[model samples]
Target: MDEETRAEILEATNRALCEHGYAGLTVQRIADESSMTSAAIHYHFDTKEELLNAFLDDLIERFESKLPCGAADPRTRLDGVLDAVFSPKDPDSDGFPVAIMELKAQAPYHELFRERFLDFDGVMRGVVADIVRDGVAAGHFDEADPEEIARLITTMSNGAHARAVALDEHPAETRRVVEDALELHLGWTPGEEVDG
Candidate 1:
């Protein structure tokens, strides 16, 4: 109901998702993780699907909030966006990214999750597109279709996510690959100083 309570529930849900994954998740598991009764969870969410949907929404919001905005320089903004997207950390320990991968795998079978996935994909692409457009405008990047570049970046991020989840690879590997791709496509180098 309140923000604190909602946060608590979300935190518990994340822990459960990390420990058990979506396939193994249950209301009782979430309740146990949160130290609340199943009845309490039910009072907040009528169904497990509802709870998961809320979790997905919260997850997307948290990611979106981390995107850099209102910056005058394209390179700086692009760097921030790329870092957020390609953050190479072990998903097994974090659980949030792994949970996202689990939800994505379920999208084809579940219409609700599929729709949410589309929306999430679109939003991420739009953020990348905006950065690409800005970079081109500033003459930092060569002329190209912003949408296409955004799509490519999204694809790369997805692949990185898969590698991170499936191979249990280091996050730095994803970061290095993404950074190299950015250098080739956007002429932006990671860790390079850019004048605003």
Candidate 2:
């Protein structure tokens, strides 16, 4: 009912998500993890779907809030976006993509889950498209189609996240691949030099 209690519930949900896949997520489990009662959780989110949606919305809001300061040049903004999204700060940040992917793989059987997941994906696509458009106008990036580029970036980010989660690839390597994708596909240069 209070802010602290709400945050604890959200934190518990994330922990449950990491420890137990979507199928295993339950109000009782989350309450136990948070040292609260299931009734408290029910007060905040009546259904499992609502709880999951809140968790995702919170994560996306955090992601949006953490974007780096915008630069005049699009390429710089693009770099800033990458850095913000891939930053290794949030404990579940790196694994979230994979976890979502797994959830998506099951969404068809659950309509609410599928719609919520797709809604987030749509938000991500729109955000990326806007960034690409801004970059193109600034002359730092080529004036290619923004929608296509946004889709490409989203796909690459998803793939990179998947690799990081699935293969246990170093974040540096994932970052390299992402940088290369930007350079080759969008005509942006990496800010750092590669020794290899």
Candidate 3:
């Protein structure tokens, strides 16, 4: 298939994921959503696993695009990353936070699922760690272990997502919960939530 077709397939797959969740996602549904035949999807991806991986690849791209992990200061970068992780807007219309929570539940029994989760988690953790290190270096944050802080931030963010899903709260409320957690954990000023 051509690049455009492949992108269309991925887009459909992403929508299917949001609409049906992981258990209900299928190539037929994706094809239907994309106005293509299931055979066309098979031409690109031989198995459901392959298609799911493609979905994850697309999601990772969206995550990076939506949550630009860049800033001059580590503290500011940390805030930005937190917002990206917990905030809802769903700019890509993927319902990513909910999908992530579902995947978290699926990771234990499925190796492929676990691997995909780890891949994105690794990227997020690395970004978090960099922000922590930069903050410490710039005297914006207290001296601490960057790696540990990164893991903590990642864990907290994921937990917040899960909580948001479980509580059926909007993204802003989820972000507020995470912001409060971060402030309590890192000793940031207990002020208003930072704007994204």
Candidate 4:
């Protein structure tokens, strides 16, 4: 129940989810991956759904931590988010996103998963919307509905994630497509030199 133990469990769950997909995941597999007994996992999480929900919470927290805060420039903040979303470190490792996609596939049938995903999606869109709003206010971006722009960006990113995971496409290719979408829809591109 300590933080270290919980983190270990989550890490193991992530590996299991990535290797087996949600449909194939099993408690014994997670236990084996974590090098913990099945009884230990059960002591921490009463059910598989509970373990998955905990993993989702941890993922959301990590994502939020990556977003810019304080007085960071709007462009810098937006770029940070874009890079995190489209061109994440270790582009070849699709474990995190693949696990997320697997959970997404379960949303239709599981209310708990659906609620957690909705929360995660909302936070992501909210972060993008905030950046767009700041950019527009700073005259670095075209005046548009921030919410709409956020939705477009989220949709495009989701598509890219799916394609990258499914086709084993390079993350750079998805990054280019996302950048183009941002430029076309928001009139803003990360790291672009602008005349004062």
- Candidate 3, position 107, lDDT: 71
Candidate 3 has a TM-score of: 0.82
What would the per-residue lDDT of candidate 3 be over residues 38-121, giving only the tens digit for each residue? 987898899887787767766777677766456645666676676677666556764656766776777787787778888888
- How accurate locally is residue 27 in candidate 1, as Cα lDDT from 0 to 100? 89
Q: What does the lDDT read for residue 15 in candidate 1?
A: 91
Candidate 2 lDDT by residue in tens digits, 28-109: 8898788889987898898988887777767777666766555435555566677765656466454455667667677787
In angstroms, the error of model 3 at 56 is 1.1
lDDT by residue for model 4 (1-196), tens: 7999999999999888888988889999999898799899999899999999999889889888877783687888888887778765464444867778788888898888888888888998999899889888989888889999788878877888788779867566767777887788778777686454
Q: What RMSD, rounded to one decimal, does every model reach?
A: 2.0, 4.0, 3.3, 2.3
Displacement of residue 96 (Cα, Å) in model 3 is 4.7
TM-score of 1: 0.90
Candidate 1, poorest ten consecutive residues by summed lDDT = 86-95
For every model in order, what is the number of clashing pairs? 1, 1, 0, 0
Better of 2 and 3 by TM-score: 3
Looking at model 4, residue 120 earns an lDDT score of: 85
Q: Residue pairs in steric clash, candidate 4?
A: none
Q: lDDT of all the models against the reference?
A: 0.82, 0.72, 0.72, 0.83
Query: Best candidate, lDDT-wise?
Result: 4
In model 3, which regions exceed 4 Å deviation? 69-71, 91-96, 171-174, 184-196
Between candidates 1 and 3, the lDDT winner = 1
